[model samples]
Target: MSSNTILSLVTPTISSPGVGSGLDVNGIITKLMAIESIPMRNLQKQQSGLQNEISALGQLTSSLSTFQTAMQGLTTAQLQA
Candidate 1:
């Protein structure tokens, strides 16, 4: 018995987009990606703002605690007067 082998060569083709389509595909994609990320950016800004508010609240609470301590001592001294 005899076997015959055949060899075939295939060439790969690359397609360049926006070549003849006259479309700014790259620019559009860039803008679309930016648009898609808007909500995340907004959420990040909101998170930062909330963090700042929380920090301010903590500072205010500490100040109020200190003031309360001072007022208690003054009240006790007056009570003994």
Candidate 2:
């Protein structure tokens, strides 16, 4: 993604509050909270990335273990021969 998109995602736009008593205070708070959650979203993204890396490492380890086992079997067969 472009830098602008990333910046927009991290930064929130604030609008002027409503002019009268009928103003939707709840809506305003919701919008403000949504903006506040940008950091949380970023952290979640980071967490997801870490989880993926961990999964990849686990797969690599399993593959290496399997290879070691196979190599040992081959060595045993050669020694018998």
lDDT of 2: 0.91
Point out the worst 10-residue segment of candidate 1 by lDDT.
1-10
lDDT per residue for candidate 1 within 23-54, as digits (tens), equals 99889999999999999999999999999999
Best by TM-score: 1
Candidate 2 residue-wise lDDT, 1-81, digit = tens:
999999999999876667565799889889999999999999999999999999999999999999988887786669788
Per-candidate Cα lDDT values, in order, are 0.86, 0.91
The worst-scoring run of ten residues by lDDT in candidate 2 lies at 13-22
What candidate 2 gets wrong by more than 4 Å, as runs, is 1-20, 76-81
Q: Give the TM-score of candidate 2.
A: 0.62
Report lDDT (Cα) of residue 6, candidate 1.
25
Would you estimate the TM-scores of all the predictions? 0.69, 0.62
